[model samples]
Target: MSKKVIHKANTRGHANHGWLDSHHTFSFARYYNPERMNFGLLRVLNDDIVAPGMGFGAHPHDNMEIISIPLSGELAHQDSTGNKKVIKTNDVQIMSAGSGLTHSEFNNSKTDQVNFLQIWVFPKEQDITPRYEQKTFNPADRQNKLQTVVGPEKDAENIWINQDAWFTLGSLKTGFSEDYKLHKTGNGVYAFVLEGEVEIDGEKLSKRDGMGISDTENVSIKASSDAELLLMEIPMR
Candidate 1:
């Protein structure tokens, strides 16, 4: 039997520091939810708003796939791999923290707050080599359809991670519909709505809403209004 989990927009854990406002979909930092820990191999999912000139300091990670998706403003990233870059809207950044790595992120603009999503997934194979990658995605390519932004293929037009999971983005017009098929059996899909409203199968979701669909090959998504969306397919193990 297929299983589904719906996460409401406001049901997530929220933390407010002087320079950071973050919402945790899974247990992280100070917010611990035994029931919300993880879905399949997907680990951390954090929606963050970083105040200008403020952000996370150097942090260490190992044997994890870390992905960052910027929504607005600029995010400056610096890592131990000698990679320093600024990520803007529609840009995706990924790091394979194999073995170990340290990095920091900050809002580049002096007056603008930067909003972004930080996600982590367990690696299929651990302790290989630390690596960093980022890319700019043309939003037009995702208009009314899915645009793959992260995958396992090196020749693909997206960032590659150290796992079999795939991440995609979509922008749909009102009343438009789309379908997403899993790349591998036993993999689950996590669909998130960034703007407007949408329906997965027959369940309605709104801005900042998320849904996990498993035990199925594909899912039907319908937009009730113009909507921006993200979909992640991950291994069930």
Candidate 2:
């Protein structure tokens, strides 16, 4: 087993748009912080809460793999590729903005807020072809266990990307523990807690806290409370 590397990132970058409140766990465009740039190939992780009837306008992207996980409410997505969809809690969406693509996301409800996590990862190879996909997963599948949501397989239940990385989600009951083995020897896992508390690799992580662990074959997680967590395993270098 390789040595484990651990640290709690200094959370930075926050923008409140009256309708949308967002927090950047890593450096993002227009919210740059060199010290919090990235964790391995996990480039961006944005925690967003969109007020009813509001969301991001149409935007363009290129050469990046994007994943959106909804925590609550509903997200309406449309793209130049002629795709239109609504994503709710337990739903996952991925867009391979290979070469280039244009898209827009909005909250579909007018009376409730929508909270979601938007993540971006660097692709192993760039400029392939633009693609989009979305899937609604059964929350029970992640109850007290990790469920693989994204991977390099076309047959995966969720969206597929162009890299060897994998994304998993888990919801642990209080006092429950689970172990996750890394997907690749040279890759690392970035764990993010969405609710409750968790102990990972001997470190404690509270709600909204994140940690990156690499150079290890596996890591264990013990929940202090009923908790929801996301783990992204990607290349380290």
Candidate 3:
């Protein structure tokens, strides 16, 4: 039987630091819910909006694979690996804080706010070497179908990560349906609705809602309206 967990949009933890407004899907910083710690190897999922010219200062992290997806505006990133770049909508960025590293992110605009998703996954192995990568994806590719943006390290078509995880994005019209097969036998898929409404495994979800499915080989998804969806398939362990 398939096991499922739902995280309603209203239930997410919120923090407003004047310049930074963030919502957490799992326990983070001051939002500590013992039962909401994580979903498999997916450690953190944060929806962040930064005011013009403001953002996070340098912070240290180790043994974590960090992925950033810009929703609107642009984000400036700098890391200890000597990488510096600006990512805008349709761009994806990944940083492997293997041993240890410090990084900072700031809004690249002075008049517009920047919104993005910050996701962290526990790596399969630790203490390797720090690295950074970024790429822009054509939004047209995801129209009415899934586009793989991040995949296992050996995958040559998309950005590579240090774990057996696959991240896909889709834009669907009402009544459109799709099936996502698990990438690994013991992996789970976390579905997050970015816009409009969707039904996953028969559970209806609206914008910003999240659902985790496990013990299943494949998942069925149908759009209730024009929608945007993100699916993260990661190891259950």
* Candidate number of the best lDDT: 3
Model 2: per-residue lDDT, tens digit, 78-148? 99899999998888999999999899999999999999999999987899889998888888998988999
Model 3 off-target regions past 4 Å? Answer: none
Tally clashes: model 2: 0
lDDT of 3 by residue, 96-199 (tens): 99999999999999999999999999998899799899999999999999999999866477899999999999999999998898888999999999999999
Task: List, residue by residue over 1-237, the lDDT tens digit for candidate 1.
Answer: 778999898999999997999999888999998999998999989999999999999999999999999999999999998999999998999999999999999999999999999999999888979999999999999999999999999889899988999999999999988678889999999988999999998899999999999999989999999999999999989
The local distance difference test score of each candidate is: 0.94, 0.87, 0.96
lDDT of the structure predicted as candidate 1: 0.94
Lowest-sum lDDT 10-residue window in model 2: 1-10
Lowest lDDT sum, 10 consecutive residues, model 1, at: 175-184
Name model 1 segments beyond 4 Å from true.
none
Q: After superposition, how far is residue 191 of candidate 3 from its true place, in Å?
A: 0.2
Residue-level error in angstroms, candidate 1, position 135:
0.6
Candidate 1 TM-score to native: 0.99
